[model samples]
Target: MTDRGRTALDTVHAQLDAFNAHDLDAFVATYAADAVIVGVAPDPIVGAAAIRAFYESRLANPDLSCTIDDSVLFGTRWVVAQEQVVNAGVATETIATFDVVDGLIARASMLKA
Candidate 1:
């Protein structure tokens, strides 16, 4: 991988680590201030604050954990990750496509599998 692609991939890994640890602050830090998140709800979530709130709601799951099975890095600007989210003994598969900008995630769209 190119240096740029490695950097973006590192950022994504960091974000995933933060999420699995339930560290909301660190998780939010990996996103741009105006980041957009799709597929979590009917409407897209805009901005860091809104994204934080959405994640907070998900914290209700005491056994929440996210595992990335595969990740395809597209240059330094995008990545497609196949993941599994397990919470409360239920596992759900998801594919998340991330748009990376300046080493931060600018947008992420997730699709349930």
Candidate 2:
């Protein structure tokens, strides 16, 4: 991987680590202030505060956990990740598309699998 590509992957890994750690603050810090999250839940969440709230709600469930399986880069600006979410012993698969801008995530969209 090129340096840029490696950097992008590292950033993504960091975000995933924060999520797996259930560190809401660290996760929110990974995105731009105005970053938008789509499809991670029933409704789209806009901005860091909203995204934080959404994650907080999920984290409130003791059994909630996220696992990222694979990530494919679409050029340098975007990446699509295959993820699995476990909550209350139920497992759901999803695809997450992330738009990276200036080394920080600008937008994230998730689709149920």
Candidate 3:
């Protein structure tokens, strides 16, 4: 992997760790100021404030935890992470595609796996 790919993977891992830790500040730090996020259920969320709110609401659930199953790189700027998310005993497989720019997430698109 190139240096950018390594950094992109690091960013994803950091995001996951921060999320599991329920540290909003750390999680938000992984994203760009105008980052765009698209998830399974809701419409696209743009900007840091919207992303923070979205995560803040979901992070309230104590059972929210993510287990990364696999990851593949697309050049140096993107990564596709397949993860299993368990919350309140319900598990969902998610495939998230992250576009990393300058070591921060610029866009994220998620799909059901």
TM-score of each: 0.91, 0.85, 0.90
Q: Show the colliding residue pairs in model 3.
A: none
Judged by lDDT against the true structure, how good is candidate 1?
A: 0.87
Clashes of each: 0, 0, 0
Write candidate 3's Cα lDDT for 4-44 as tens digits.
Answer: 44478888898899889888888888898899998854688
In model 1, pairs of residues that clash are none
Per residue, candidate 1 scores C-alpha lDDT tens digits across 1-113 of 11234477788898899898888888888898999999989999999999999998675556999999999999877989999999888889999999988778889999998
Model 2 quality (TM-score): 0.85
Candidates 2 and 3: which is better by TM-score?
3
Top candidate, metric lDDT: 1
Clashing pairs in 2: none
* TM-score of candidate 1 relative to the true fold: 0.91
Using lDDT as the yardstick, the better of models 2 and 3 is: 3
Off by over 4 Å in 1: 1-6
